[model samples]
Target: MTYALIAFALVLAVGVALLYNKLVRLRRAVENAFAQIDVQLQRRHDLIPNLVETAKAYLAHEQATFEGVARARSQAQIARSEASPTDAPSMRALAQAESGLGAALGRLMAVSEAHPTLQADAQMAALHEELASTENRIAFSRQAYNDSVTRYDVSVESVPGVFVAGPLGFKPAESLLEAPPEAAVAPRVAFA
Candidate 1:
């Protein structure tokens, strides 16, 4: 009877240790995923200046648009640096800042469309292509981050983990950046 009790306690100890380690591993994965997002966001921010300068060369009359882009970019940089991707409030602020930057970029692109010369410029075309590619990468990174967060949250809230997580103070992580509502709906296309 004594040996049976000892064996049961030992098994329980091992189980708890394993679960704790698994929780820690999941938390680390979430952090790494968010780091990937940070890398892509930095790449996008770096490209913005070059893109803006290229547009400036041709759209000399549109000073205000450029200023707006600059301001938005600056705000985004601040938000990106100040906020952790796993924190809800900080992530929301970062998303808002990024949306503002996207809006500025869209306006610049629209205005550039009116200038045939700018459209024809090879440099502008190349910058636009790079920007598009970077946007795709950012999207992928965000998806990965969200997936990691989901997995981590599930582990924290499920089964034996539920018993361990609360005492360990393991809270669910926030999802990655979400698309702004204005950008969520597909634009209607009429072939007329």
Candidate 2:
């Protein structure tokens, strides 16, 4: 009877240790994923000044639009700096700031479209391409972060995990980024 009890205790100890280690791994992964997103967002912010400068000459008439873009970019940078990947309210604020920046960029792009010379400028073209690529990378990073969060959240919420995770203080994480609404709609083509 003594040996049986000891064996049961050992097995339980091992199980608890494994569960603890697994939780730790998931938490680290979530942190790492968020770090990647932060890097991409910083890269995008760095590129914004160059993008605006490249378009400035052609957009000289649209000073107010430029100001709006500049303001939005500043707000986004501040928001991004304040946000942590795992915190929902901070992430939401960052997202809102980013959305404002996106709208400003869209207006800037529209202004560019009006100027054939601006569109044709080699430097402007390259800047546009680079900005587009950075946006794509941001999208990819957001997806990866969301994927990691989903996995961690699931592990923390599921049957056995629920009991272990709560006691361990593994709170659920929120996804900060999402595809823009326009991305869900199919493009319309008109042939003249």
Candidate 3:
């Protein structure tokens, strides 16, 4: 009976250790995903200055639009800095700021199209291309983040993982992607 008890205890200890390791890996994956998102977001934020410069000369009357983008971008930077993985509220705040910045940037892009000279300018053209590429990268980052969250969520919900994760306060991450407003929809198709 004593030997049997020891064997059972050993198996239980090993099982708990494996579960703990799985939880740690899932947590790290979530952290890594956030870092990936931060990288793309930072790249996108850095592109704003060039976009603003490209629009400046031709958008002299659109000062408010430019300022809106700048202000929103600043808020996003602050929010991103505040997003600690353990703080759900801060993460939500960061997501909200990012969404606002996206809307403001969209408006700036729309205003740029009104200026034929700006559209034709070589520097502005290059900036425009860069902005498009940055946007694409942001989209990819969001997808990656979502995928990571899904895996983490699955791990946390699984049998042994759940037993360990619950005690450690592990929860699924909120997705960073925001849905587009239908009423303010940007045209998907451009016509010549």
Scored by TM-score, the top model is 1
> Candidate 1 lDDT, tens digit per residue, 18-77?
999999999999999989889988998998898889889998888988998899999999
Candidate 3 lDDT over 34-133, as tens digits, reads: 8988988898899898889778878788788889999999999999998865566887888788888888887887878867888899988888788788
Count of clashes, each model? 0, 0, 0
**Which candidate, 1 or 2, has the higher TM-score?**
1
TM-score: model 1 vs. ground truth: 0.90
Question: Lowest summed-lDDT stretch of 10 residues in model 2?
Answer: 183-192
* Candidate that would win on lDDT: 1
Query: In what order do the candidates fall by lDDT, top score first?
Result: 1, 2, 3
Could you list the CA RMSD of all candidates, in the order they appear? 3.7, 3.8, 3.4
What is candidate 2's lDDT per residue for 19-89, written digit by digit as tens? 87888898898888888888887888888788788788777777887899899999999998898766889
Q: Native-vs-model 1 lDDT?
A: 0.86
Error of 1 at 11 (Å): 1.5
> What Cα-based lDDT does every candidate model obtain?
0.86, 0.82, 0.81
Q: Which stretches of candidate 3 lie over 4 Å from their true place?
A: 182-184, 187-192
